[model samples]
Target: MSYREERRADAAAQAEQNRKAAEARAAQEREDRRLELETKLKAKEIAAEQKRRDAEAKAELARKEAEAKRRQELADKKVRAQEKERQAAARRARFGRVAGWLKANPATLFVAFVMVASIVPAVISQVGALSSAKVHVMLAALLAAMLEGGAWAITFMGKQAEDAGRETRKYRIATWLTAAAAAAVNFWHGLEAYAEHPWVAVVLGGSSLFAIYIWDMKTHGSHGKTREERRQEKARKKHLADRRKHHKEIAEEADRLLSALPFESITEEQAFETAWQIKRGTQPGLSAEIFAQVTGARVQLGAAFELGEHVRPELVRAGMLARLYNPLPGRLAEGIPTLGPSVPVPALQQAPEGATALAGIGVYGSEGASEKACEKASESASGNAGGNGSRGRSDEELEALLPKALKIAAELVAEGNQISGAALSKRLGIRRDDARRLRDRVIAERKLKLVEGQADAAVGA
Candidate 1:
């Protein structure tokens, strides 16, 4: 064969080898894809199995938790039932204890019974009284209860106070007052409702007082204040009330004193007395400062009396002197307003003829005084100048600003913007007069330039 045919044969073998290699490679890739698909199928099956197992486990857990919750609820119900039984037993025991106490204290039970029985009658009587007065039913009932309840409350408090060995005077007074008011109301009610029978009204009215009286007597008996003692207490209370009314500041001061001292170290009266001494300066009615003023005034009065001893003679002498003088004296004292006003001078007139009083001083050649007067005049003139020396714009500044203002005006005109004296004033920071002058110069130059331009144009033509 030829060399070209050999080269062609070698190239065909290489191409054939490449085609087989590419086919083998494609077959291997197809096998790899089949294995990968099988692996994904197995993984998906495993995941599905895991999800089924997790769902089963969760369902079992929920069933177990439900069973546990059922058992817990049963236990809680049993506990509540047991607790209810225990509470029932406790209530019974408490009721028995109260029954035992009531049985043991028959007298106390009887007293309670009596209180109830008495309360009903008194309350009914007072309520009836109030009802007859045309009060509201609820209000009448409340008022009746208040009167009866208040009286009994005071009576109860008095008993407690007696047991505690405290003063029951206030309680006794309060109870009696409440009882009296209630009795009066009942009396009025009965009298108004049953006008024919006074005894019925008396009985109704006495009913309110009778119960409270019994309670009061039982509570206080002989332990209460004696009549004399009560009178003394009332007098003492009046004295204190008067003191508080008349001297509120002093009463407040006394309270401060009482607070400052140890508890119960002094009585209220003692405290008030001490405060009065301190505040009123140990005087009952008058303060020390006021006393001092009064004494000082007395001393001044005595001094005035002593002065009168000698002043009377002087006064007599003055009267004689006054009588000796004539009413119209020829000579007038200088600078006295009542005597006559000082003479008003005529308009500027030349000094009367010859030598003036001060004229001779000039003839003596008072050069020092003249020099001083001239210096004063010059100083006054300098002072006046300093007082009002606000200078106007200098000629140079005005001239310089005038050129600048004209230039600015020309620019404004070129820009088709108007220029006026006020606008020039701001541009040059000059006075209105200076700005007006500058603006006028600008207008005059403009006219002159215009005229010159016309003349030139005419000449050229």
Candidate 2:
């Protein structure tokens, strides 16, 4: 019993041990399989998350690209709109200039209307669209009336302007005659004849209108200025030119007179007395103040009359005043003293050689003439006394007189009067020197030139 029991017990115990070992192995295998499954599941979840992130990045890039495309489209649209506006503005400016030009040229407008109207009727007649002879005649009459009316109106206005003294009556009679002739021709041909020869009527009417235009242009100038205005302008220019020429001549004469003096050989008193004699001979009754002023102007003759280069009138006047008022040291003052008592003058039997030269030089009456001569001179002088005097004239007075003086000068010049400084002095009642200076200033400012042959014509007159 002991041997059998021992063998069985040992086998059972070994079997039990084997069963436990198998159970342990099975649990380990199950745990390893569960771990592998959990690892695979985690790897799949990570891969899905990465795919989601990639899709979101792609969507963001697409959104940015779409926004960029939209902005580009808007910019392009704005550029196109601006270009269109610029083009439209340019077109408007061009049209505006064209309109302004058309407005300024009324003659061109009338011509354009005539051309277009004539063309329309002619085209209709040629196309046989308007077969009515009466219609063509009516159109012809209308065109003829317009042409005749325009011509008549222009002629009537010109005549009225002439009557109003706004224009010279140049071509007024001729213009009326031309207008009447045109009216007569148009009406004499009659409407039915015009319809039969529509083109002939157009030609005749166009020619008459053109003739009127040409006549107007010839008479009134292309700018439509009246003949009187043109004449006045011409006269004004001539006057300024004559004045300039006169001034130049006077300046040259003054230079010549100064050049003839011998200052070095003569004493101051002798030179002064000689100059005074010459001045008195040339311009009798000249006031002491004016003589003093003249002496001051030529003071460059030093203490004696001296030869010098050409000098301006203003400079001469200034020199004379300075010499008389401001004496050098150790020299007698050359101041102009008060006038002596008046003395009876002797009558001259004949005109002096220098009398004519002195005729227009001074504002005072001519001396040493016979009683009758003096009376006659006084009558002529009285009319020009107020005009030719500069004495006591204020600045305002001079300014007020200037326009009228200029107008007279212009008229005189237009009449072929060669206005010398002496003549201007007499006419304006100013000093010869002052006249010279004023003439120069006006000519320069006005940009005038003497007409060719005007001086010869004036001298002859």
Candidate 3:
């Protein structure tokens, strides 16, 4: 009974211990599964967060790109708009000028053209009926008139530029028709003279034919033409017409300015040359001040020989007073100091050579002889009378006329008086740092004369 009880108790204790160990192992396995599930969920959440952030960043980048594109397009549009506006403004200005020219000289131009076409033919007929010598003279005159008339009509009518080109075409056609008709009439007369009096007609007809050949040759300024040649001729003529119109506008502007300035008398050629020079501004002689005066030009030379009171204002505004002012305009005659005419006083002479040379150098050749004479006389007299005898220019005068400090400094550099930066600084009385800058500037200025060339040496000689 005791052995059976002991065996049963031992088995019970072992069973209980085994059950506890299995329970602990099961608990541990459940905790491990829970931790794995939690770790997987956290990983999924982190991945989702990363994807969301990436999507947000991409959206922001796209928005920025679109904004940049829109801004670029707007800038381009603004630039295009500005360019278009500038072009339109230029066109309107050109048209306005053409309109004004036609309005101002309408009657004169029309009458001139009509007389040229009609009067020429009438005179030729009249002269032919008269003496033989008269006939030749009249024929020559007629030919000249015809050539000039054709050119003027073509040039003006083309520039009369209305919106429609139809009018210009009609005008051109009329000019050609008139030329043909005039030629036909001339041919008919030649034929009639030949038929009526064979001997005299031969001479007259030959003479007329010769005249015709001369006219065509001189007028066309070229050889015979083919179909392609004719097309090119038409294009060239159109180009010439455009040039003439531009010239006409410039001419009209000149006329208006001349009428306003009663003191000085400037020719159309002078005005044109001056205006062109001012506009180009490519030369060192033409400074900013001179350009300003020319661009703002509302004055021109007049028939009046004497300089007007307005000269002061113009010279002052032009910054040319220091160079060209005359002090005798408002001064007393006695105080002005009169010189005896022994060694040819500059004022006594009608013209001097220096003014002419200066004018040529300045490219202002259309200056009136009378104006040049006056200017030369005044300038020479003033320059000489103030300080010296016949030789002119006293030591005091020379000293007074010495170049300014800045001018001296510039001249030294221009003459290549220095090379290195330190040397240049000493020569120019400037700092070493400034000398480097000046050297750079001088190098950039392409036309600055750093050395006295043959031209200067010759001039000095």
Error of 3 at 186 (Å): 5.4
Model 2's C-alpha root-mean-square deviation from the true structure amounts to 26.0
Give the number of the best model, judged by lDDT: 1
lDDT tens readout by residue for model 2, 164-221: 8786454466565655566345433434356676666555444454555554564356
- Distance (Å) between predicted and true CA of 227, model 2? 10
For residue 216, what is the lDDT in candidate 3? 36
Q: How many residue pairs clash in each candidate?
A: 0, 11, 5
For model 1, which pairs clash? none
Across 412-457, the per-residue lDDT of candidate 3 in tens digits comes to 4454332222333455544433433343343323123423344697
RMSD of each: 32.5, 26.0, 27.0
Q: Which stretches of candidate 2 lie over 4 Å from their true place?
A: 1-31, 83-87, 104-107, 115-236, 243-461
For candidate 1, give the lDDT of residue 87: 100
- To one decimal, what is the Cα RMSD in angstroms of model 1 from the true structure? 32.5
